[model samples]
Target: MADFLGTDANPSLDGILYPSVQGSEGKLNVVLFHKAARVQALDIPKGAEISADLYVETEDGLEIDYSVWEEVPPESPSATSNRDPLDAREPEDYNGRVPTLRLNISSLRVHRVNHIMFHTESHTVRRHRFEKRGAEF
Candidate 1:
């Protein structure tokens, strides 16, 4: 299989770092990489949980493997909220308004913008493998 999303194209980015994550609970980037294949980078955030799927091509074009990572907070007292449970992030003041967690999938789709549905897990990190197919089975 020829992996695309996780492969690092830039030398500056270097090798895949274990844990493959950065920043704190409120804000962070999930990074995946492979040294070969000259593929573009795939950097994702919590919002990617719903927006897209990450895939790697196989020797047979008929098949492709995919994975997804969802963002979740640890059991932190500070993370508890008083507002609506559906609210994705903590409220904050900005321009006399509050800020929220708007779903963003920019870095994850730098290579292309094809509609995809990645996998998910109860924990923050999730990885899966699937064959690209004709039907949603």
Candidate 2:
């Protein structure tokens, strides 16, 4: 069976990126629902937001550097102004590339079990599933 998450360093995420890892450093116990996927919400820094990246492992039994996540654009938007709970007006349109989390699995074993590590700009590793965002999936 295909591991819903990757094996060892070669993780295979469902493509649904969560805001942050669960029960980690500064993350809170909040739920983030985007599209149709529901994920545990991450309490990131004041200006930080959701982002995605592929985590890969090499044949040398070493995990790939997490810096590659920088290439992909975060699917979620950063906190913006207009925080009126009663307001219904739409905020500025967010048009950007879908964040792509790439992994380098050049020498990874076929059946090795791996886990993907989500992180913030401060480099906090998240431990949770990247479920569908919003609620549409």
Candidate 3:
């Protein structure tokens, strides 16, 4: 069972890495696709463009996951000069050794954000199935 959209504190994703964008305060939504998968597209920010289906490839030791996201203070020891600021194009992956997010001046801002809804294996369907992204499993 996935988190769907609610903020699930998945400890397994504590140390996984992800490209951190600058001032990207918008909450990230992970939409998983399966035969029983469903989609709920909500909250289209002003003048935001919908991008392609994001494919996060993971294999071997390092994998893609999410943790109970926390904001890192700028003066903290872990959030020191040792780390680099992240931009959209030149974003940085900070969840390497620990969960960290560093803010800095950049041309990027939080663009479009959508509340993703997911469906898991169940006897009956709950929501509208996202057929395009769905697959047999």
Candidate 4:
């Protein structure tokens, strides 16, 4: 996914673009969706750790190093049930749940970001899934 500051075509995003967004004040925020297909293709097991590096390109052809924010998991059903009515929270879906692995670009100043790139890596550990009943085989 890519976000641009102005309404124009970004050559860097050609051929390998997901979606684009227009912003103001030369500030752009990008989000990479973690869809079900990607999850299955990568074979991302449950409780896996993933990380990524973020890079941005300015309108003036200047490459900048933007800060990468970690993924924030959505609130669980039990956690939401304990929330106070006055507390502010994001709207829930039909199943009262929110997905994860949505990236956000957090920059203090306007960099006129025109394109974004993410280099991601995942570290998964496999564990035995078996229960010993009354006696071992």
Provide the clashing-pair count of each candidate structure.
2, 25, 0, 0
Best by lDDT: 4
Query: Per-residue error at 113 for model 4, in Å?
Result: 25
At residue 111, candidate 3 shows an lDDT of 45
Q: List the residue pairs that clash in candidate 4.
A: none
The CA lDDT of each predicted structure is 0.43, 0.43, 0.38, 0.44
Q: Tens digits of per-residue lDDT for model 2 on 1-137?
A: 22333332244343333344644766544321222233333334454444543455778766645432223335456545447766664656332334333334454344445775656577678799776768666
Pairs that clash in candidate 1: 6-33, 7-34
Candidate 4 has an lDDT of: 0.44
Residue-by-residue lDDT tens digits, candidate 4, 1-137: 22341223353322223233344345555533232112112333334456754556778765656553445455455543455767765655123223433333332444576887655579999888886779556
Tens-digit per-residue lDDT, 1-137, candidate 3: 34432234443322222343433446444433232232333434334444432234566545433222233334544433443356433335222232133334244244456664444466975787554776679
lDDT of 1 by residue, 5-122 (tens): 3343443442343331233336544343333224333443323443335556667654444445466535456654467756565455213222222335444333545765545456
lDDT of 1: 0.43
Off by over 4 Å in 2: 1-36, 49-82, 89-137
Candidate 2: worst 10 consecutive residues by lDDT? 31-40
Q: For model 1, how many clashes? A: 2
